[model samples]
Target: MRSRSWVRTVALGAVLLGAAAGQAQEGKMSQGVKAREQIEERYRWRLEDLYPTQEAWEADFKAVETDLQALGKCQGRLGKSAKGLGGCLDLQFSLTKRFYRLSTYAQQLNDQDGAAVQGQELNDRAGKLGTRLAAETAWVEPELLAVPARKMAALRKARALGPYGHFLDNILRRRAHVLGKDEERVVARAGDMANLPYTAYNVLSTLNLPFPEFTTRAGEKVRLNQAQYTRLRTSPDRDERRRVFQAFFAALRSFRESYAGLISGAVSRDHFYTQVRGYRGDLESALDATNVPTAIYTNMLEQVRAGRPLLWRYLRLRTQLLGLDKLTYSDLYPSIVPSVEMPIPFDQARGTILEALAALGPEVKAILEEAFASRWIDVYPNAGKRSGAYMSGSGYDVHPYILLNYVDSFDAMSTAAHELGHAVHSYLANKAQPFHYSGYPTFTAEVASTANENLLRLFLTARETDPKRRLFLLGEYLESWRTTVFRQALFAEFELKIHELAAAGKPLTADLLDATYLELLKEYYGVAEGVVEIDPLYAIEWAYIPHFYYNFYMFQYTTSFIASVAIAERIFSGDAAARDGYLAMLRAGGSLYPVELLKLGGVDMTTAAPYQVAFKSLEKTLAEVEQLAAKK
Candidate 1:
């Protein structure tokens, strides 16, 4: 993955490997996790792929610093000639390649053990170096845009600039928003202040605010961190899950005022940027960054809202299978059927994921095998290691690296499949496109990953002959759509509403937020139709989602999942053209805009057809699950 802008990273944690959203740290680890040194060498990633030694890393670090001066030499010369522009771009890519390699090494090292001071120092230095590189290359874009249109057209025709035509076109497309140097400098200065709200929220949630631990009804006492709260939600014990939910929300409620204030400030920051960029509103501003149209956003919300019947049906299915008189928000987590916990060992997961993704064809299968054999993955949890899973493809010149705390569950296996999708996508992109086009945008980023996840689920469902386990697997598949599409679309609606409210001069207080969220929850969950009940206290659930700080990011998960369903269905049905088209997409990377690329890959988000396909898939699974539930 290319480096995310720091402000967005601060908001979203920059999980670039594009695994399924809402992943939890679940499953059994023997005793507690181990220290990094205790893990066997084969299980850990070989950072040597990047640099053989710390000394080599330091050498490259200095080399990048030295090369920074050469970029400055191209600053005023970009518009002089096509060759001048091409030279500056080539130099920028060269310097950026080296800089990212150094940064990736330090970042992986630091993530391995965040408590280590030396690792922290190295990561910090890499961050500062990136800022320096940004400063040095800041003139290139504005200068290129300043060039006369006819001159840019002539430059585009130059053989030297052939590979960068799309790149230059993107800059020209944003010419209206690209400010003059002095004004750009002023906006850039304000960029430094934009992270304050997010920083404050991080500090409050992750560090300062106190969340007391709660003991489950089964006598296991658990601390109420974000991961623990997630793991406890699916507890077999209904009372236990309720205790977990109440306790977790109670903590969030206690800090309601503080959270309300912080989130309000974050919304204001978004509004500020939207206005400065001359966008009509926050949604337009946020979507414009990815060159997505406002229609795609509106269309997603509209489709999901219109698909409420499917959601209500799924909710009713859950109630019937769980043997509850009525469903409540607290009852939503337990598996619809008695879940067959498939404890897939690490080696088994590796093999299973390889087989599951074989539908993408032999080339993808080969890439997955390499990912396993080449030590491209760091595959277990250790003391002070980062929580959750992600793929760091920042090593553009090298193979992608994946970080996994692989707990032995079916979900863990699915995570493996999802992240390997990202890894292989990066592998193909980096191999097929130049360095500049190698990194894909977030709009299409989750397509390959989520498609892999769907493929894995379909593979598992096909093989499970036992009726009960098949039902469980089917429910698992439906639950994925519930969370990824239906639920995230709901989140997208809430985010849009809140942003609109703030932009319209409505003060966002805890009460207002809670009421708005509660109303939406009831509407989507069909509380009025008696599909589920929303407890008033659960209205504060929005306060718990860290992704709200991510500024209109949750919708892509829905859009991408919808597109992937269409793509995966075609490939799984043995369509040769679809398979080739999907492969072409993975290889295209950022060479095309996300919407265009998805269209080429057989799913077009601009229309409602793909969303209808997704809903049909959900409806089909729900019908099967409903029939299976009758047998129970």
Candidate 2:
């Protein structure tokens, strides 16, 4: 469900798109990361869960590729009749499932060890296979639409086509946008070039970028890689954090020209598609894939802007807790409860997450138990392993696999809960729906994950008798909001502005991008209002975020975080119907539109009430933390 760099369209929807958020693993980073074989088997994910061995994976890949090639034989014949169409549809989903399985396996293996020659080979093969499938099946929609109108209506109602009704209907609904077969192939063939910018960025950031070993103020010599910077940014020593910030951003700023060009190319790719597809712009084209209204994106920006006072309120609280004269950009990452430590070892994390998510019922508990037991997760950072955390639940027949650079901190534990939320959502969807409809859309993707996080926060805050730790837990919830809700909206707005800039024919340069980013940083952190000083040093922060390449993917984090807050509150209130409805929505999956799915889950994202509830909840929680801080 989550990945890096590329996304490919499939029978159901945009199946393998990546969203950039290094959502977790904010603990200490190993200066010298251990080799993969150095980790215990239990800590390593069993890709054997998907395939027993590389030979098995290769065989499956060959079979899937061959089947995909065979599907090309059915191209123009798709409009022939109900049975013929249904047969082709069945083969399409069937092969896509195997294709996805192949992709997940290769990709995860590659991430688990980026330097592995086998991983690189298999990953490259998978990418080529995806391109082949795209070029081969490019005629599907256009041909499906070419069916005679009366016959197509009958096909929609045909019992043989019942499972594919929604999938077929989605294709038909995109009639105005679906290109002719030849044009579609032309676009599909452009996949490799279209992916060049992000691919380069991902390669540079993940593999090739050189991070210097910097000495901390404590005289701790550490390699300031992505994970290390993430961990050290939380250092309580102000001057030390300032040094870390300077070093990290200075490193990123050094490569700003390349990052700027790569991002501009990304925008240009979006721009080209926008023009080719007859969309107004990139945002609409991205959101429209799943029938999501662009209004929700704009509304999220407006709502977060409206909630800026709360942000400043929280920032002030943070300053007070840290005993700061004033907050600055470097002050952002250190825990407000600097004295409290929540170091959760990986084993302890399993029990903690299981207990936190217990309200989701026995089924979810069973899944978590299995997830921990079955080695469904790769649980530690290793030399050459991918950074950050993500859960892939796209392989319908196989269980979800999570990749975590777990260093045994509270954030690492929270990452487990968050990713497991995605796992359970996928498990339930796969269990309840046919493969054709097993995948949920991007809109609802974060709801379950963030809900699990809320559950963890609430559970910890309630039982934590240690006042300091309780404060830590409560502050973490607020921080989660700041990062997910506030930070993401800022990203969404920045993404919008840049795309608009490109659309207006302004060429993006490193300086221009930095200036634009600096402007947003000032506004969002309330520099003008003195909430937090926006250092120009952090202007290159955009270069560090991988999500800038996510093609309007950042806004979903804010919306889903808001939705999860509402969902978690209902369940916490003992609203039995709400809990059941929410679980049902997980099970509903891609069977319904995302808005309808949220309604089924007892929160209508289309209405103002959910957003209202979320903001009110933030206020109440802020008041609680403020009261507790007052006692201090």
Candidate 1 on 1-632: residue-level lDDT in tens? 21111122222334531222222222223347798899988889999999998899999999888888988788778878888888889999999888889999998998877878878999999999999998888777778888988878877888989889888878898877767778877888998888777667767876776777888776777788776787788887778888888888988899898889988988988998887778889998888777888889999999889999998999888888888898889888777777686789999998888877888889988888888998999999988887667787889988999988888988777777878888988999999999999999887777888888888887878788899789878987777777877888888999999999998889999999999999999989998898998779989988877778777888887888899988888788789999999899899999998788887788878788988877888888888888888877
Cα lDDT of candidate 1 equals: 0.82
How do all models score by TM-score? 0.90, 0.82
- Candidate 2, 494: how far from true, in Å? 1.8
Residues 1-632 of candidate 2 have per-residue lDDT tens digits of 33211110110023334232232222334459898899999999988889998889989987886777679778778877778888888888888888899999989888888778888898999989888887777668777887876878976777888888778777787777767768978988887798788778877876677787899887889989887887888898899889889988888888889999999999999888888889988888988888888888888888788889899999999999899999998998887875566688988988888887888888888988999999999999998887767788877898988988888788778878888999899999999999988888877877888788888887887788887787777776788778878988898999999999989989999888999999988888888898998778789988887677768877777888899999998887678898999999999989988888989999877667788888888898799889988999
lDDT of all predictions: 0.82, 0.82
Weakest 10 consecutive residues of candidate 2 by summed lDDT: 4-13
List CA RMSD, all candidates: 4.1, 5.2
In terms of TM-score, which candidate is strongest?
1
